[model samples]
Target: MLRTGAQYRDSIRDGRRVWINGERVNDVAAHPAFRPLVDIRARIYDMQHDAATREVMVATDATGREVATGLALPYAKADWYAKRRAVDTMMDAFGGVVSRLGDETIGEMWSLHDGAGVLTSIDTHFAGNIQPHIDRILDQDLFHVSANTDPKGDRSKRPQEQDPDMLLHVVRETDAGIIVRGAKYETAAAYANQAFVKPTIANWGDAKLSEYAVGFISNFSAPNMKFICRAGFAGRGSVEDYPLSNRLDEIDTLVIYDDVLVPWENVLFNRHTAAAAFIRSTLHRYAAFPFLQRILRFADLLIGAALLNVRQTGLDKQPAVQDKLVQLARYREGIDAHLIAAIETAQESPGGLCMPNQSLLYTGRLLGCGEMHNAIHLARELCGGQICVTPSAADFANPETEAWLNKFYSVNENWQAEDRRKLLAYARDLMNSDYGGHRLTFHLFAQSPPYAQAGAVYRNFDWERSAGIVARAAGLSEAVDGRKEAAA
Candidate 1:
């Protein structure tokens, strides 16, 4: 069912296990570190009920019931729609800071397991891991976080080769469920979510370590689950000292599970090695699509901001500045063009779900990373050092420096120097601050390494047929020779 923003908020407030630092967080709905994320999630929930976004955020299920798009949409179609909706969502909210968290960004990942059947095989492991969570989370509009990649103590070693605890695993199984003991690092929005879904990065065998391979969903407030909050740029100082962007926190965290009990119903896949494998493949298959939308939206914002800065600084008339602006516009168009291409080339899977063309999606993903970096660089170059040299908001309130600061900082004759500087500062913060840096890192690390990502693209492509076409064009086909000889 479509959930209202208030319902979503109240559901999370009812009960959930979440910790910040060493203390148990009694009130996540009101916590400084988590409130911003909650606010963003609420906005997404509100969109479902809004007349304008309702069509995109709410869809009719196979059962013909109106449900939250997050729970009702099929994975393939959902993946495509999610990317489109994400662009609108980001644009509606101002930018990535107020945008939906990545975890919530791809809610249809759960739907990938809907028809995968039992999780006894290794190939189906990933689906097995997620199936249970899908059922549990559907009951309420819960914010779900994923923990798949573990902090491998040694980069070269596998989970078994390294310290067992280096990756999360189930230590024991009871009639109630399984007991998991280990830590999951780099979990996005852990404190803001109601439940955390744990899945193995890859499948593993050996009954002794099989628990580590199991996938399950558990309440964040489940017994023994601890949240160690990561440091945040905005939370480091007093509100007066922080920038306007500081209030919107997107902190990475470590989820410590010390013998946390997950009930059987919550178990999506348990020691079924095959199911775990399928989950990973399915996730990898659609991983690039969402980021493509995010990058496109970001590019649009960057271009708009750059144009504004140019006008504000009276640099629109400068040849070099205009050229830079043109180049930036082209870059934005290039990324967006690829996204459209990917969508146009989409195909349906065996399960009758639509998925974006893999080759085009990967190309867009890599291009997105480079484009975002370049966009930021262009903003900096066009804005000049004044982007960073602008005084703090506090300086405007000071009686002594106010007038002089305004006079010198003003760029265009008609624009108030203080107002122009403030706009530039906000843009600069988006381009220069830790918040900006985190987005860069997220894009870089979102999927596998660039080389691997490219390799997947090549592997998925139908190159043999293209090669055959070239061979035929070059008269290299034996059938053509045979026909010519017969005629002679």
Candidate 2:
């Protein structure tokens, strides 16, 4: 069932409607803005078939079918380790970070799989749809993405009062399936095969059933699905100056659903606010691990850029500079420690799948995302002012001023002018470019906002044990343990 790179490319050429920079794109795989990421994604697919990486990237299912390791269901700790290895291998192959790939998005389906029982309790009609889709992703090797954020017309007015289609809703149901009308802000939607579309944060009020409470898997190439993507960072500058920007820009899209039909099998839930609420609360339960892992790798890039900058200028000998480098190292280790601990103490999910420890994972997410801006600033400071004022690669190549540029940029026999200029250009793109700023914002809010992260930690952390310990320390009577039954 493992697809080749060519087959993967052929799947997305199904005439999906995609527009970027006010022009219609006939082939997303060939478009300059999307081609880099598309080719990287394709290479990941090819890696599964390559002799060197086939062992790490592909795994056998119970049925003896070979599947992409990234999409396989987790049955044991080894499964998790394999999945982690696959992600690491893919990133290593790409030479930069690309977050919206298949591994991160597939976990959303697993999260829904964990909630199958709760979904069944809410409505028995659609409970059976969860596992099949999860299996479909594995068997088909599909590239899946997520959709949650929608443009709500007004904060105060409800969807019913204002534009009804502000939030995605089920306008009507047909014998074939349901007709949905709305839009979602999704990353990698234009080139992706499918998206698990769902509602954003919604206040259901007292109503048990609302039209806004809907979740479905939509095919990207389906009729009336339009992908309006943000202008890509690629092709904005020479690749020599903006290497990371050109190679790793994951273009986001506004996916518009103009009365699209969702087949009955694709409907995960409908008209059940409780189901929607349950999903919203636990949406990132499985996905957060991969999402945070990307940030962890990014921390390495930050530390690398800063340390190289300091070393190139002989600033590493200074105590203050060394201390700053240590700070960045500690930040990187903090992310690593949480990830290691979460897996070591992994908990079993209701669906009989192993999950990263909920408490550590959520708190880890908070720590990694909450202080990223500070870490970036520290890295920027350590990289010094040269990263901003450095001359371009073109200037170094020009015969007119090449000698002067070389004389100033060269530090020692070991640190030649060309290497120094390359390092500075890399540092600038990693920390100071528009791409750098966009990355900061993505990590901060990609897995919900900071407040939501804190909320997850609050809900998952064990408070009853601490409450009991405090009660015992204070010598409270059994009747004063803050129990309603004891008070009664």
Candidate 3:
């Protein structure tokens, strides 16, 4: 069932408590800070119904029911291609990148669905809940997000030793379901419908039973849930000056679960440390594909901003400037190559779903996110100092300063002052503004930190293949192969 834009907006207007900038937002969809993203999300929903986009955004499931293309579980290379095309279409439509849309978050459910074996081994009842929820999201066309990071009060002290609520845990079980307490740092939680709440810390450390090892689907509008969001960047400046921030600021929230209940059907895994550990290791398996795709799009924005600035100023003729542009192109294509290569070498998940090549995907994530700062710096340098010193749109329009500003900002016949001002303003927001800095930090640490990214690469890479090659090259003993076999 494909949902329309109005339906999607109505779903979230359930009077959920949402706070931003120390004020309670009565209508998140109407609030200036959130309205832009909310409208974008709504437009994405509407795209499914629009005749031009319906074919690209909607697909038929196994049951012959039409659903959002992004929510459909990928079964073959064609399915992946369809999802990729759908995402590309949406990004093109929006004219900017915005993650945390339903497409990106739905993959978390697929990751857990792949872990049905682990879930079943722990408890058959737990395993039964996976597919139904997967169907529920597609059928209802709901917006889902993820929750993992919890405020671990002290790294050295355990939850029992310090504050028990530091990490989200099962407080107690009730007739309906289990009640959970604590919080999670979630992006788009205020506007999103549900979240796949789970443990962020992977290590259980020999304890067989732990309340911390719990996973469940929590409704965003449920009782005791509070979405306290960080101040938004939308209303901070004129749209002409901070266009991306105004339209693309995905407000992160500290979602407090004040003893929220999770119905039995909603609990994917509870008090099962093995299942929790499995999920933590493989949580981003499918999700990271879309996550990395966003970075690739951002790379395009960086390159475009830099090239436009250089071209407008006629600096593109310089060899040094061309080298910088080439470097930016390489960065963009590097991410693009990884994405295409991963899909080309796609692997089948244990649950029979097609997953992008894990090794390539993880390595690409590290490359895309880890080196984003350098790319941003290069783009910023290429845009020159003009981006920072450009006067506001108001100054250009002001009768007192318009002529003088125009005289200085205008470069040539084709390069007018208004055009130059707009380009610099865009470049600033993309590379130098508060929104730009926040985006960089998010790319750095959103899907775990740099250290964890390295760890994922280590865990997924084919070490045995390398080991066998080195053993043959160096004429080493067969012990290395034996050790690899033993490790496997």
Scored by TM-score, the top model is: 3
- Candidate 3: tens digits of C-alpha lDDT, residues 312-403: 98999999999998988998899989989989899999999999999999999999998899999999999999889888999999999999
Question: Which scores higher on TM-score, 2 or 3?
Answer: 3
Q: What TM-score fits each model?
A: 0.84, 0.97, 0.98
For model 1, the run of ten residues with the poorest summed lDDT? 99-108
CA lDDT of each candidate? 0.64, 0.88, 0.90
Error of 2 at 449 (Å): 1.0
How displaced is residue 281 in candidate 2, in Å?
1.4
For residue 42, what is the lDDT in candidate 3?
94
For residue 202, model 1's alpha carbon misses the true position, in angstroms, by 5.0
Error of 3 at 167 (Å): 0.7
lDDT of 1 by residue, 1-488 (tens): 55676776676664556666566778776777777666777777788778877777766666577666644445454455664774466456644444335333344353355335544443443444554455445545566656665665775776678787877777887988888878775544454444445454553544433656666665665667666776656665434434434656566777777888888767776665555555555555544665566677777767777888788767789998989988888877887787777777777654555666777777777777756777789877887777677777668668898888887877656788666766666676667776667667766665655665676667676666665566678887553444343355
| Candidate 2, 1-488: lDDT as tens digits | 78888888999999999999999999999999999988988888899989999999999866688898878877777887888788888878776678999898888898898999999999998879988888888888999999988988897987899888889999899998999999999889988899998898558999899999999999998998899999999988888899899999999999999999999999999989999999988888889888888888889888988988888888999999999888888888998888888888999998988898899999999989998998999999998999999888899999998999999999999999999988888878888999988999998888888988999999988766676677778877762353432246
Give candidate 3 regions above 4 Å deviation: 480-488
In model 3, pairs of residues that clash are: none
What C-alpha lDDT, on a 0 to 100 scale, does residue 98 get in candidate 3? 91
- The candidates, ranked best first by lDDT, are 3, 2, 1
